[model samples]
Target: GLPPLAGFFGKLHLFWCGWQAVLYFLVSIGLLTSLFSIYYYLKIIKLLMTGRNQEITPHIRNYRKSPLRSINSIELSMIIYVIASTILGISMNSIIAIAQDTLF
Candidate 1:
């Protein structure tokens, strides 16, 4: 079994590569985080609709259209920007991979 999270980070630091400096690194991380966010977004919707967290309380009804959270303009634009950047970065990665394949 793994030692602990601190030991894991220490080992990760030991293996840090030059690719960490590249723009594509952030792009890949952002893309993965975006997917994770979508998963949680679905979870929140399920919680609201099914009143999964409302069992403890009885006043709140899911029948009403109550928006407990919302996406503001800045947040919406950032999401769009991140999605576009991730797509472009993944496309660039594909091209690079193909080029590397042809070279070898």
Candidate 2:
């Protein structure tokens, strides 16, 4: 429902047309590509679902804290922006609406 969202819609339209279109081959290719994409999407999902049991290393640095022992304002704002954009992008038709709302 992300990158191949439009492709799925196209597939539906093609099927609705009873497969009598001149570009039936294109539809077939699209279907095959969509099928292949499922493998990749599921692979990513599987990787995310399986968590690592490794413990955090003490040597790892924490950049979230500023040198003055306070939380960094800029870093916090950027994190919020990234989170908001991701949520909005998934909820809306496309990011164009978000961009327009942000810009204008």
Which candidate ranks first by TM-score, i.e. highest?
A: 2
Model 1 residue 98 CA deviation (Å) reads 45
Error of 1 at 54 (Å): 7.8
Instruction: List the candidate 2 regions with Cα displacement exceeding 4 Å.
Output: 2-11, 14-18, 52-104
What lDDT score is found at residue 77 in candidate 2?
90
- What is candidate 1's local distance difference test score? 0.63
* lDDT for position 35 in model 1: 69
Model 2, range 1-104, lDDT digits (tens) per residue? 34567756766776557466667777688778878988888776775678542333444323355688555787779999999988976877666877888999
Candidate 1: tens digits of C-alpha lDDT, residues 20-67: 656566656755665686577667768878966854345444344336
C-alpha local distance difference test of each model: 0.63, 0.69
TM-score of 2: 0.40
